[model samples]
Target: MSLSDAAELLDVHKSTALRILQTLEAARFVRKTGAGTYVFGSGLIELSELTLGSMDLRQHAGGLLRDLQRRTGHTVHLAQLIGDEIIYVDKVDSPAFQAVQLPSRVGHAVSIYASAVGKVILAYLPRQERDRLLSHVVFERYTPTTFADRDSLEVELAGIRQRGWAVDNGEHDSYVMCVAVPVRDSRGQTVAAISVTAIEVVATLAKLEENLPLLFATARDVSAEMGHSA
Candidate 1:
């Protein structure tokens, strides 16, 4: 709709309509095509992925996640970001950590500010929506490494995008660290993410770095299975 059309429909001023359109554009709900024209965005592809559901996607990525977990001897997570929360849809526990594995389960909730998986999700969101969501979050400290505010996280998210992955650095648990990469859909939109976490004693930052290539390879394989293209 044109700015005037939107103003007329909502009975608001033209500038107010423009601001509304700007927010929508930032959230990827709509894209301005011209001076006043707009159209849908690739984020719409997210709806199709959700409608297809998690069961089938789990089946597609389960074997790959298991393989990655075994190779690194760490917990592997497959999660989707729904709004401000990361929903754990699948997990592969490493046999080596059976005695002290993380107590994560399918459908567990994690905050976007305190997890490798969560940071990857936040890093890939449409900027306006990401900032909007960040504004509402209560920055409670889960660990000394946890982000104390949005500015700290904004810096972290920028690094994540630069490297195509994120690291928790014991932000969620004082003795645990996780490395994660985003999973994109066919339209090149990130719809989910996968990560591997391990106890700091055995899997420190160096270990996570060593496993980064493998972790990203596994993510690419899963994305390919989901019909995602470059």
Candidate 2:
């Protein structure tokens, strides 16, 4: 639909719609055709590929995650941010007796307000975009530890951005602890996240802190492999 039509549907002024359309066009999210009508652009298609190419990333990161797991003896996961959620693309299970068994199937979705991997991507998103998403979604509580309030969640996301990582302290699932670092593209924009999840009994905060450097290093390596850089 045209911007004016969209604006009317949303009950906004026409100029507001025009500005929104212009912004999206500038961001390459929309294309103006010969008749000045806008439609989803090639950039949106490329971004969709970047987001949904979990199989491709899994194939590429499989060996890497395995190697990392072998080196650290901890479970590793690769996930992509989709809207307000994270979808697990691949994982490497630990050989340890008490390792956490994550039910991360090929297309299972996880919440950005709860999961470490999801939070990492959300924290790096542009502030306006992040606020818009948060405004649209109800922050459902998945566990006792989940962040249920927008203000508190905003504070937490800010900290995650500053630290360059995110942690889930039994937020989405009880007895599970996770740490995640952002994976970026060549533009230095966060495109995905790499995480390690373990049973709380085996993965204490101290252990997670100790492994933080390695996790960040591995994420950087994977991002570089995907043509992403700092």
Candidate 3:
């Protein structure tokens, strides 16, 4: 729609419509045509697809995630690589950790290089896609353990690829620890990750690693539900 049409439909001033269109265009949610009209952009389409796809993934993985949380008595998170960010698509809070709840929630974004879920998903992405995502990030050393630079993060990512999992040893928050494994789709693409997290007081990183076998099994089961084979 043109700015005039949009303003008419929205019952707003043309200046307001132009401002709205400009903001949307910046986010790539709308594109300004050469003719000075507006249309839905690829970003909007991609976000719509991510929403629908993540909904399906959440539904398919819900029970399994809850079961894993129950067995481990720790928080479980399912995060997906959505566009340029890694977003938590689902979470199962541990009943045992009511006193000190982890900060993660569904629909929240995680640091792409600092969190275990983020690293596992990034490690499995194609090199070009990985580079594209990292190119925009301004790394921060959230803790002494964070991979705050590209070179160090690359080494961590390489280890994750070799071992097929990632660990956050309080990288983002000194008290929080996590272990994550990749969740693959039908085409063997790593589209998401499953993580079990806890505070150091509840479970150290080593304690969390003890649950790796179960975590890996849960990831495989969820991946299978996503139509992955072998």
Candidate 4:
């Protein structure tokens, strides 16, 4: 698709799309052909391989997520922020017959302003960096609950930071709800987020509040296992 088409499809402006395309092209993740149409570039394959090789946390997270799934009986996800998106590195689904399946894959990217895991990380970022990142975002409304205004989103992010957790109440997808906690490094820098997602019917506010401690404890354990102190 042309830049204009892509921008419209993504609910973003043409200039924003052009800037993203240019950055991806400069990083060799995208290529503009003679017709001015962009395509995935060969360099992305190399970068993908390099990233896979360096993903030690993903390796460990798989097992940890499995344990969390067993303990909580909810879908557990481990994700890291990449640019303005969150990439799910690992996930484990509950065996419960009625459990909802989350559409998460190892390299799949999700909107930072939409998902609970993404919001947790975004909330902890420096204000200047957060504003810069949000300025480039289009704030697409995926559902009725999605935060589409910058001022409202900023206020919500402030709450996430103060609470040290994030909740997605059918924001990204109308039928899904998620609760996320940050995983910090040794220096207390937020590196990623771990979340439990389920169908809205099953992931009610009361249920999420009941499970909050378990989610926080698991995140702390994962952080410590990754060589983060405290």
Name the top TM-score candidate.
3
Q: Can you give the lDDT of residue 117 in candidate 2?
A: 87
Global CA lDDT of candidate 3, please? 0.94
Clashing pairs in 2: 185-228
lDDT of 3 at 85: 91
Tens digits of per-residue lDDT for model 4 on 45-118?
97676466328777766677788888888888888865555788777876654545666776788778988988
* Per-residue alpha-carbon lDDT of candidate 1 for residues 1-230, written as tens digits (9 for 90 to 100): 77788899999998998999898787787888867587787666765666365666788998999888788888899998664567899988776655676866888887779988888988998998787778878898988999878888899999999989998888878888888999987777787899888888777877887898998899899888888876
Candidate 4, which segments miss by more than 4 Å at Cα? 1-54, 98-100
Residue 69 miss distance in model 2 (angstroms): 1.0
- In candidate 1 the C-alpha lDDT for residue 24 amounts to 79
Q: All models: lDDT?
A: 0.83, 0.80, 0.94, 0.81
Score every model by TM-score: 0.76, 0.75, 0.88, 0.75
- Candidate 2 overall Cα lDDT vs. reference? 0.80
Tens digits of lDDT, candidate 2, 156-219 = 9999978888998989787778899998877888868988888778878568768888888888
Lowest summed lDDT window (length 10), candidate 4:
94-103
C-alpha lDDT of residue 91 in model 3 = 92
Candidate 2, after superposition: displacement of residue 194 in Å? Answer: 0.7
**Number of backbone collisions per candidate:** 0, 1, 0, 0
Looking at candidate 3, what is the lDDT of residue 74? 93
Candidate 3 — number of clashing residue pairs?
Answer: 0
The best candidate by lDDT is 3
